[model samples]
Target: MGFDADTGRLDVTPESPAYGTKLRWSAPKLIEAANTTVRGANMRTLNVLSPAPGKAGPATAAAAPDPRPTMPVGPVHTRAPASDGYHQALAAHQATRPERHVDPTIAQAIEAQTHALRELSRRAFPDPDPDSIENTRAKRRRDAKATHAQALRRARAERAQRGSTAAGVQAPSDRRTA
Candidate 1:
């Protein structure tokens, strides 16, 4: 990822369909969205359902403004640490607006999408017990290493035994003829 200080834009290469769009992050944004749920606006649902920008019907001189879908992912901006406002107004608007929610169908769709992605991830990757050996390949590898070590030990023992015997046996020509 590259960030431009001039334009304040981020440049990121796209990932493949399956891997690129995986939602691995946990964001307070989701909670915030739930709180700021527009009364009648289903932004995401509309983005999905409507025809893409410049693909709507016939292009007209004065038709509705070119439609732009709200993308699921947006660039994030990090703020540098700054002094807090000591006199910031607390609850400047005294009127209490009760919690509002998006359309039921849109909410259901959002939840369903979340669940589906989670299911895909869970099924793709499974955690195996660390204490117990489950994979046959690992077991085979361990067995092979053990067998090789045993072979090495046997060869060394045989060499030591032969060396000891050779040393103990007196050479025929070394006998004194006194």
Candidate 2:
């Protein structure tokens, strides 16, 4: 006789009495038998349909108040620290300094040129109303123009303070050839 491990089949010779006999069991009956045996042994068993130990039944447990307390509720606002190194640096940079001497004519000319350029830009790309919601591109262009004009003004002021004239006017060093 030989046994097939994969199929759980036992092969016996034709001469044996139990050679052709097949074995089977009822699943429900087997489960009931196991439960009865476990109950007799006084062992704990979990069955979803049956009442749990220490509880009257499913309905009584459902009707009883929950033992766990409710979670406390409150505002969830968060605040970041007021001061940082970047803010300190910005504050220092924005601090006013003593004014230097700059030619009024040169300053006026620079301001006039900035205004002309701003007008040209406004004509080229007409911006939407300030109150309108969708104006990101227009806003960016305006900001860029303002920043560029401010930079130009600052540069012109610095150059005038250094005794340099407007554009095309050569420096004192450049005036003398080597």
lDDT of each: 0.52, 0.57
lDDT of 2 by residue, 1-178 (tens): 4444455333333222232232122334534565587564322221222222363557665777888998759755588656799798877777865567899999999999999999999988776576544577688889999999988887776667466555556555543211
User: Using TM-score as the measure, which candidate wins?
Assistant: 1
> Candidate 1: TM-score?
0.24
What value does the lDDT take at residue 126 in candidate 2?
75
The CA root-mean-square deviation of candidate 1, after full C-alpha superposition on the true structure, stands at 26.0
Q: Judged by lDDT, which candidate is best?
A: 2
With a 3 Å backbone cut-off (N, CA, C), the pairs that clash in candidate 1 are none
lDDT of 1 by residue, 1-178 (tens): 4444455333333233333233213123433463367443222210111222343345443565557866658666687545455223334333354567689999999999999998998787655556445575689899999999988887876676668769895334443321
